[model samples]
Target: MAKLIFVNLPVADIAASTAFYEQIGATKNAMFSDATTSCMVFSDTIHFMLLSHERFRTFTSKAIVDARGMTEVLTCLSEDSRDEIDARIATAIAAGGREDTDAAQDYGFMYGRRLEDLDGHSIDLMWMDVEAAAKAMQPPAN
Candidate 1:
């Protein structure tokens, strides 16, 4: 069976976060969604669980840090091309997210942008040419 990943995030507002994910092309899995929890499906194997502060607290004893002030997790998604990366960032910005243009990284074979969602969770959008990246990583012969 294929492995699947579900990222759980503590969100300030479930409705706003759900709309943000939906605007960026993720579909809501109604089977797992309710007033305090939303299942946002990015792909067949990738999913995000947006949980309210109270709901998230039930999963752990540690206090939930405010994502707006602290950097917790940096989630990244791969894009098909450099253009696609920029496009995705643009879409995210249009949906009330903000792109950290100063954090943009660009190499000849790779490009990436750091985007912050409404609740200040960071999401990185990246594109890379596998062949070029592999060549760049190879050590020179003696």
Candidate 2:
């Protein structure tokens, strides 16, 4: 079986979060979705488990920190191109998400933009020109 990664996030409103993810192109996997939880599939290998605060509490005894107050984890995903990154960010904002306070970054071969979901989870979208990036990192001949 192929290895898969599931990133679990605690959301205040399960339905709204699920819809937000869906609006941004993620497909809701009904196989694991219910009133308190949703399975948002980003790709074949990446899946997001959006769980309500109550459902999330069952998994851990620690208190859930509000994401809006501080940074916990910045989830970043690589994209095919800069346009793709921009499109996703625009979609997120249109669906009620907010752009990151910092400006988008351009590092010659890499470009990145960030957005926050309705629940304030930081989502970063990045794009890199693989060949250009590899060449840029090579040491110059003496």
Candidate 3:
């Protein structure tokens, strides 16, 4: 069986968060979704579980911090190209997300940009040429 990852997030509004993820290319998996929880699939193996604050509290005893006021978690995804990253960022912005253009990371062979969802969860979209990046990381000859 293929390995899979499920990223759980506490959202203020399940519907809004579901819509936001959909606008950014994730599809809601109805099988694992309900009124207070949603399963947003980014790929065959990558999924985001959006849970309401009340629903999320049942799973953990720790206090849920405000993502807007401070950094909680930074999620990064790979893109097919730099153009795709830009397109996704624009789409996210149009869907009520905010882009952190000042956080753009560019290293010639690799580039990335970040955006925050309605709840301020940061998602970074990146593109990289694997071969070029490996070459860039090689030690310089003496």
Candidate 4:
């Protein structure tokens, strides 16, 4: 069986977090969901376990970082195009998430936009065109 990745995030409200993720095109996995947690599936291999604060605490001894004041981790999602990255950020804003950074990055080969979820988790929607990157890496014609 293929290994699956489960990213467990602490949220104040399970339902609200689940709804936010739903708007961003994730679907709930009813097979592994309940009142205390919701399994938000972004893809076949990637699953986000949105757990209530109390439930999340059980898994870690460290205090939960207050994301509003400091970043805990930056979760990045790759897209097929730069427009797709922008659209995802826009959708996140429309869904009540806020832009954590002022502008999208254009590094010649890749582009990205950052946003903070309702619970302040930092997420980056990015597009890295490998062909473009490879071209950029090539030495200029003499």
lDDT of each: 0.90, 0.93, 0.94, 0.88
Model 2 C-alpha lDDT per residue in residues 1-142, reported as the tens digit of each score: 7899898999999889998999998999999999999999999999999999999999999988788888889889989999999999999999999999989999979999999999899999999999999999999989
Give the per-residue Cα lDDT of candidate 3 at 136: 96
Question: Between candidates 3 and 4, which one is better according to TM-score?
Answer: 3
Give the alpha carbon lDDT tens digit for every residue of 25-131 in model 3: 99999999999999999999999999999999999999998988888888999999999999999999999999974668999999999999999888889899999
User: Across residues 1-142, which tens digit of lDDT does each residue of candidate 1 receive?
Assistant: 8999999999999999999999988999999999999999999999999999999999999988777788898898888998888888889999999986456899989998888888888888889999999999999989
Candidate 3 similarity to native, TM-score: 0.96
Best-first order by lDDT = 3, 2, 1, 4
Better of 1 and 2 by lDDT: 2
Candidate 1 wrongly placed segments (more than 4 Å): none
Instruction: Name the lDDT of candidate 2.
Output: 0.93
Give TM per candidate. 0.95, 0.96, 0.96, 0.91
- TM-score for predicted model 2 compared with the true structure: 0.96
lDDT for model 3: 0.94
Give the C-alpha miss distance for residue 89 in model 2, angstroms: 0.6
